[model samples]
Structure formats: structure tokens, C-alpha cells
Target: MAEFYHSVTLIEEKCVGCTNCIKRCPTEAIRIRGGKAVIASERCIDCGECIRICPHHAKRARHTHLSRLSDFTYKIALPAPALYGQFNNLDDIDYVLNGLKQMGFDDVFEVSRAAELVSEATRKLMVSGKIKRPVISSACPAVVRLIRVRFPDLCDHVLPLKSPMETAAAMAKQEAAERTGLPPEQIGCFFLTPCPAKVTDIKMPLGIEKSQVDGAIAISEVFPELSQKMDHLETVETIANSGVIGVSWATSGGESAALLNEKYLAADGIENVIRVLEEIEDERIGELEFIELNACAGGCVGGVLCVENPYVAKARIQRLRKYLPVSQNHLMGGPIPELMGWEAGLEFSNALTLSADLKQAMQMMVDIDSMEEELPGLDCGACGAPTCRAFAEDVIRGGCEKTDCIFIYRKQMQKVADTISKLDGLKQFSKEEKKD
Candidate 1:
């Protein structure tokens, strides 16, 4: 089994165990045990859904702080395109890019530039028809992990291309090393991430042995300082190179739209993406050449780490898009052919299977079904499981017990009382007969 480390974690003291996270979790990966939320490492997709739903602010994304920049001789910031939408009424994208440089970064690399390269590579892959039908986008790490845990069969449909963040990190490091004559180890590439899933991806990337990104900084953490710097700027640098096609990748349908002349479907939000994946698994949408699924609503703009409201951020991205030139006129660059080398190593992590032995797993399934029949059938999270059936499964798997169900425990206590009453009645009747 592969080791798992998640970027989305719980701050135990703050959690009230209110079932907010467990109920909303797309995967029933959360359980309220000992009055604190416990996340099953294997089941978690690092989607940050819990982080969004928790009222106590207990759930948080683990990320590297700006202070870590001092460790490296040269620090480069790889800002996600979604970062541009964080500011209110921001006119030029360069302001955000320049702000990053002012915040101690030696250079700022736009992930959108890498997105353009990914778009081209994806277009070529789709045109070639070398892979399976309805190829899924690999841009969203959360969605990729969702498929790994819940929709393992659909793993083959996931595109093997490296995410824009990874590509940008790789390029940034190499370019920085070359320009500065600094050792690659001394030049650190830090991703400005809008989501915890990206942080997890940087730490443990799929389809590759390791990530090129040295660290990740949450967008929400940088938003306030960056905004102040942008406000104080006298003149913003004209260094924004990515065009509309690349920049638009910040929102939903943007990726599909960029892949011109293709029959593509885009789904945003974790629930909607799950529905689309289900349809694909059922072969209902086989004719579609590609499918883009974003875990966050309105795509990256809705990430838990993002500062602005998703709808407002989406509007900002649209307005920003209007100022950019067309893809052909402002082509940033093409795919780095070497980055595709990771494709060959791509394989399903198979995080979903319950047991390795077929016979044992079959028996466990039978036990789960039997146990579920005895449950209250409420699908309530009171028993620390999302559904009654899931609770039964957990019981059979030894993670929980049938007594954990309040109804079941009450019924057992009632039975005990009835048995005691019967014994008392029988003893009193026998004593009366003896006296007669």
C-alpha cells in the first residue's frame, strides 16, 4: 500500500463534531470519533470540502509559509491563474504578478503559461484518438483523487498530462537555474495555490515519482499583503504573457473552450463532477471526446483558500479575459516535450478496494448487507457514518460496532427489561400456587 499524506487536516480543538463535514463529504472519509473529526487517510481526496463546510474553521489546508523563502538562494512564485481573480476590480494581471515580486520573489512564473502548453498537448492527444473515450482532465488534483478512491474503473479515462502547476514548476526551476547560474537546489519554485488538493499534489504528485514544486502557499494567506502591494504600486510591469485561452482556465468550461473543435463537456463542483463521472462510467456520454471536471464550484475560483466569492471571482476572470489577445496572436509557448515523460509511469493508485482477497471481500459484503437490514435506515450521520449502509460496512470492517447505533442500543435495552419482567411474573405465579 502507498503512504498517504493529506493537505486538508483538522484542528482537533476547534472541532465541535457537528457532522457538518461528515454529511457534506463526497467520500464518507470523515467520522466523529472521541468528539473530533477523524479523516480516513486512504479515503480522503484532499478536496477541501470539509474545510469549506466547517463553521468552526477547524478544517484547514496545510501549506508552506512565505518565510520558507529564506531557505532558498533564489525564490520563484508560480501563481495560479485563479490568483488574478482574488482582487476586487483588478484591471491588469501584471499588478498581481508584480506584487508577488515585491513580496520577495525573485521572479514570478504564470501557471497560465503552462496551462497553454497543457491545452496544446491535450488538443493533440484528443485529435490523435490514442486513448479511451471521454478522456478526463487531469488539471484538478482533487478530481483525480476522487476518481482514484470512488471511481477507480474510470482511472484509465484520466489524461496522463502533468498539471499546469507541475509543468510551471519544472520550467521555472530550469529557467531560473540557467538565468541566475544558481544550482537547481538553491532555486525553489513555490506554487501559489487556491486549494489544498494542489498542495497535496505538490507533495505527492500522481503519475510521477516526485513533484518539481518545492512548496505551496495558500492564495488566501497571500491575498491581503499582495493587495496592499498592488495598491501601492506606481507602475505595474507589462510582463503578463498568457492569452485569454490560458487565463480562462481559472473557471469552468474554460478548458473545454480552449480545446477548440472538440466535443467536450465541463462539470464544476464536486457533486456535479461526480454525476458526470457516473454518466461516463455508465457509458451514457461515450460520444464526447473529452470531459473537464473541476472539484470546486466555478472551477479554481471557488477553492477554499481563495479570498473572493466564487461567483464574483468568476465575473472578474471573465472581465480580465476581454483585455487579453486571442490565443493565436499571443501564443505564450508550446508544451515542454520532456514533461510528458511521466505519462509512461502513470497507473491507478487503486485506493478504493476493501480487501485483496476476493472471497473474504465477498463475505464482508454479505455481512454488511445483513447488518444494514438491522439498522434504522435513516442515512443519518449520528452514527458517524454518512449512510446506514456505510455504518454497517464500517461495523463489519471493525472500524465501528452495531451498538454505536442509538436505535439498536435502545432496542437491546428494551429486550433486557422485557426478559427481567417475564422472570419476575413467573416467579410470583409459582409462589402463589405453592401458598394455595
Candidate 2:
């Protein structure tokens, strides 16, 4: 069965045998062979890191193009809060919203509106005292997948709210249809996404039965048009509907600010987030109810699929926050969206959904363990596999042969040399051939 999204793939022609991606992948999903890169699907988390780092732009995120929106009678744009950080001097919210319209989206919805709902939901979850301490954010799909694969034990601590993208997609679809008298199918809710993981999330939702999002357009794909559109539009910043609290959801610590909880902590970037999650899993940060983790540094603003410099984007985001109107007290008002029953019970499936059978995985694991013990431990990527264990899995999967392992190949060469020497002693033809 094909996976819903293969986050990382190879562009054979662009590869220069640099081996950069093989070393950077968190899951060790990439390999270099025949002077090109290859992706191992089962190990990929779809973080989009490789896409950002590839100078040749060989790595591409799988996203729906804006033209796909033509299929629907009504099109609504649901821009992730991180999308706001893509442009410099984008202090005016209206200009940003209008930019989406100019790009052919009929309507624009703030992901912060869903952030408002998420904020309310998170506050209630913290106050209800029903969850285990240090509730993890489900906003970042990469972070969620990391928990599933590496920190499976910490699955219980994750907050169950559907991601802000899901929240806004649902709200936009339901409201657009109700107000416009269109069927749900006629209304397209397109997410302006930061990474490929969100694309995969929309295709295969974790901890939820289904996602409300119709499709997604990559931010990088639409950024050029948005930039051109912004040149003519007047600045229009709308803060009354969803204020600063919701808008803050874009960057690191933005969730904590929305919650107005000083006790909780927010962390961003994959490696940093993983380290913090590991500590949390070990009970290092005890008695905390909220943990916001974003896979990209500086939050979604720093996503791999983004166009602008992340640091400059983060600064622009800080300026935009000043105009937002959501206050802690205003957010506390009755009927907060958070009170709307958004939480879901998180239960991880032990069965590897990516694999066809347990027997194959077990056999692969055994082979991996054996090969790993014999490896040089340098993780050099010279053998065309990201790691020795990965090479073993490739051998088991038939993508590679045992000789792909440098150590195994060396051993075979030694045996060949010994056999040639032994044959030299018994050779009657060797001397005759040399004379000839």
C-alpha cells in the first residue's frame, strides 16, 4: 500500500554526491547511491528539513497548487499563522488577507481564529486538571510523528485538540457553506501550509478519524504572487475578530502566551523539541500542564517550505503582534471555543502501519542489529545508506545487497584475495599464461 505522503524524495539529476541530506535527516531516511540521493519512506517523518537545505532545490514538498481550487464553486483560504511571517513589512493584516484574494482565493480565514479556539481549548484542558501534567501541543505534525516513532511512551501527554489547521478548516467549511448556501463539497478550504508534514497530516490525520481540510497550497509556491499583490494593496490590520493571543500562535512561546500561563513552556526546532520531549518523557519537567513544540525554529515562520529568511520573518511577526487585540481577560469570556469539546483520547497503535507484516519487520530488525554491530560507527554515508542499520534494512527490503555494507564488502574482498592465493599454489595454467 502506498503511504499517504512520501515527504522526502530524490531528484537524481540534481544530486552532486554531497551527502549533506543523508547526514542531516533526523530519522536517517536518506541515502546516497550512484552519486544520487534516495529516500526511505518508513523512516521519514516529513519534517521538510531536507527540502530547505538542498541547494539544488531537488527536494520538493507535495502540495496542491492554487489551480486545483478551480474545482470548487467557492474557495476559501485558511492561512496558517506562520504564513503571516512570510513577507517583510506585512504589518497590515488586511494587505496579507487581500494578497490571498489577489492570488485567486475567494475568501481568507485566519488560522488564528482556530488559534483562538485552540487557546480556549488549551486553557480549559489545563484548568480541568483531567490530563497528565505537561500536555504536549499537537499543532506540529512533525512533532506528533516524532512522538509516535521515537517517544512513543510520551504519547499520553499530548493534548488532543485537532491542529489549528484542522480547526480552521472545519470552521471555514462549515461557516462558508452555511452562510453562502453552498454544499460542503462545493466549498474548498485550502490551507497555506509551511511544511510537507501538514500536507501528510491533512491526508492522514493522527489521533483523529478524519481531517476537515480540503487541500493545501505550499507557502513557497504562492509567496511570489503574494509579494507582487502586496505592492498595490492598502494596509488593513484586523484585530477585533481574533486578537494578539491568537496571532501569537505562529512563533515559539506563542502558545504559552495564548494560554497566558507562565508555568508552561514552549520549544521549537526539531532537535531542540526532541530533546525537551525526551526530558519530559523522563519526568524532568514535572508539574507542568502545557508543552508547546514546533518542529521549525521560530515556529511555523521558519518552516522549510517558506520563502523569506526565518530570522527576518520572526522580527516582522513580533511587530504584527502589537496590533492584535486578544487579551487574557477577553479570551476568558464565556463560551470560549476551547469549551466546545475539542479534546480527543490519544492511543498509539503498536502495529506499524507502514509495514505489511510483523514478520518482515522483525527479520529486518535482526539483520539491522547484526550489521550495526559490525559497522565503523562513523555514519559517513560512503556506503550509500544513512546508517549501517539503514543499509541492513535496505538489504532486507531488496533495495540494496549485503555488499553495500562497506565492512561486509571488505570481508568478501579479503576472502577473494585468500582464494586467489590458494589457487596460485595449485595453478598449472598460471605459469603457462604468464609465459604466453
Candidate 3:
């Protein structure tokens, strides 16, 4: 079995075994055990949903730090378009780009620039009659991983394109190598990430065999110093190259709008993304040309790793795009670059399946259904599992016992007490008869 890399981690001491994180997880990957929360590695998508829901801050994301920049001879920063929304009243994008340069980065590359190119490529691909209709956006790693585990039937419908971050990292490294004559390994391209899923993508990437990105630094980790530098910069270089189409990708609907097609739908937040995926799976929206889904609420700006309020950040992004052109990046005209397309197709993960063998899987399904029928079906999360059906599957898989459910435990205890009481009554009656 292949190993999985999850950016989300549990700080054992901070967890109080609360049900909040477990209930909110789109995938039933979390459970309470030994008075603490335990996450199933195979099922986790590193979506950061738990990190956002946990009250005690027990759930945290493992990300690269600024100190790691010292490892490279030349450091390049690939700022996500979401970064543009973090600052208050951020009128110019260069303030943020220049701020990154001031923070020891040798150069800066906007992920949005790559986003524009991706948008262009997507438009061209849509015009060609090659891909399946209602192409799902492959931009959000969390959403892609969610589809891999949960929506296997819709795999082929996903866009066969690399994410803008990957595109930016590859471009940045190539540019640095040409300019400074530095080897690819020495010139590190780090993404200033808004979400933990991107960090996981850098480790266990889909589509591509390996990620070009050297590391991923959380936006919250860099926001403080970057803000300080932005305030004190004596000179702001005209480093911003992306336009409205690229910058607008910071929020939901941005990508679909960039397609210049009205026959598209955009959904944000994991719950909504799931709903849209289900609709696609059911073939309910066949008329649509594209579907853009963002796992984070409001889009990338709403990532748990980001410090700004998502709504406010979205508003700021809208204001910042007023001075920019529609789009500055365009394809040079030809076949889509092989570098911008996925090398491998998304494969279904059996992490959530009962068994791989057809007959055994069928039998397991029947068993799970029987067990589920016996459960209370409240989905109260008392048994550590997110739902009654999930608890049943866990019991059948030997991860837990049927008695783990509070309702079942109480009923078993009641039966034991009744048996004991009956034995005592029979013992007293026999003793009375003997004395008589």
C-alpha cells in the first residue's frame, strides 16, 4: 500500500475529544478514541476543515516556514492570488509582491499569472470537442482528493490540467535557471499558500508524478512580517503582471467567469462542492459546459491558514481588480503545453470501500446494511463515528465494537441488570420454600 501524507495534525494535549471536528468533516475520516480525536490517514484529504472547526486549536497544519528559505541559494516566492486579499485596503498588488522581495526572496512570481494562462488554456480546451462535458475544475487539491475517494464515477469529468500553483512553480524555476544559471535544485520556488491542502499536494501530488514546488509556506505564517514590510517599503516595484481575470480567481465563480462561458456553474465550501459533484454524478446538469468547485468557503481567501475574514477579503479583491486589465497572460498559440496538462489521470481510492473483491464487497455491503439497521440512526456522533452507518462499518471492519454506541451500551447494561434481578428473585423464592 502507498503511504499518505496529510498536512493536518492533531496536538493531543489540546484536544478535548469534542465532536465538532468529527461532525463537520466532509469525509467521515475522524473518530474519538481514548478520549482524544483520531484521524484515519487514508481518508483524510488535508482539507483543513477540522483545523477550522476545532475549538481548542488542537488541529494544525504542517507547513514550510520562512527559515527553510536558507536551504536554497535563490528563493522565489509564488504568491497565490488569495494573498492579494489579505491586506487592509490593499490598493496595489505590487505592495504585496515587493513586500515578498523585501523578505529575502530573490524574486517573486504571481500564481495568478499562471492562473491567467490556465484560464486561456481551459477556454481553448473547451472549444475543442475532446474533453467530457461539464469539465470539473482541478484547481483545488482538497476537492480533487474528495472526488478521488468519494465520487469515483466522476473522475473522468475532471479537467486534465495542472493547478496554477504547479504551473507557477515550474515557470519560476525555469526563469530563475535561465536568469541566474542556478540549478533547479538550488533555486527553490515556494508557494505562499492559503490552505493546507496545497501543502499536502506538494508532498503527494495528483495528476503529476512529483510536484515542482519546493515547499509551501502558510499565508498566516508570512502575513505578519509581510504586512510590516509592506508598511515600511520605501519603494514599491511594478512587479505585478496579472490582470483582472487572474486576480479574480481569489474567490468562487472567478474561474468560471474567466472561461467566458455562461454555461458554467461555480460552487464554494466543501458541502456545496459535494452537492455539485453529486449533481454531476447523477447527470442532472448535463447542459453545463464547466463546473468550478472550491473546497474553502468564499474560495481560497477563506482557507483556514489565511488570517483575513473571507467576505472582507473577497471585497478587497474586487476593489483591487478595478485598475487591472481583463487579462495579461495569454497562450502563445499552439497545442496546450504538455507541462500544463496532467500526466496521469485521477484514480479512484478504495480507502472508503469495504472490500476490493466483488463478491466479498457485496457480502460486506449486506453486513453493513444489517448492522446499520440495528443502530439508532441518530448520527449524533456519540460513538466517535460521524454517523450510525459509519459506526456500523467501523464495527464490521474491527476498528470498533457495536457496544461502542451509547444506545447499544445502555441496552446491554439494562439486559444484564434485568438478568441479575431475576436471579436474585428466584434465589429468595427458593430459600423461602426451603424454610417452609
- Predicted model with the maximum TM-score: 3
lDDT comparing candidate 3 with the true structure: 0.94
The predictions' CA RMSDs to the true structure, in order, are 2.0, 4.1, 1.2
Cα lDDT of model 3 by residue, 1-436, tens digit: 3598889999999999988899888889999999899999999998899998898999999999999999999999999999999988888899999999999999999999999999999998999967888899999999999999999998888899999999999888999999999889999999999999999999999999999999999999999999999999999889889999999999999999999999999999999999999999999998999999999999999998899999999999999988788898989989999889999899989889888788998988899999999888899999999899999999988899899999999999999999999999999999999999
Q: Compared with the true structure, what per-residue lDDT tens digits does model 1 show for residues 1-436? A: 2588899999999999888899888988899888789999978989999998999999989999989999999999999989988877877888999998899999998998888888888887787787788889999999998988888788888888898889889888888888999999999999999999999988788888889899999998898999888889887787787888888889999988988956899999999999999998898996798899999999999998899999999999999888887563222355438775355534555455667899988999998899999988998788888789879988998988788898899999999999999999999999999999
lDDT (C-alpha) at residue 380 in model 2: 69
Q: Tens-digit lDDT track for model 2 on 42-150?
A: 5677888888788887887788888899899999999887778877776667787887887788788888887877877778778887777888888888888878777
- Reference-based lDDT, each prediction: 0.87, 0.78, 0.94
Higher-lDDT candidate of 2 and 3? 3
Which ranges in model 3 have alpha carbons more than 4 Å from their true place?
A: none
| TM-score between candidate 3 and the true structure | 0.98
Q: Which candidate has the top score in lDDT? A: 3
Ranking by TM-score: 3, 1, 2
Worst 10 residues of 3 by lDDT: 1-10
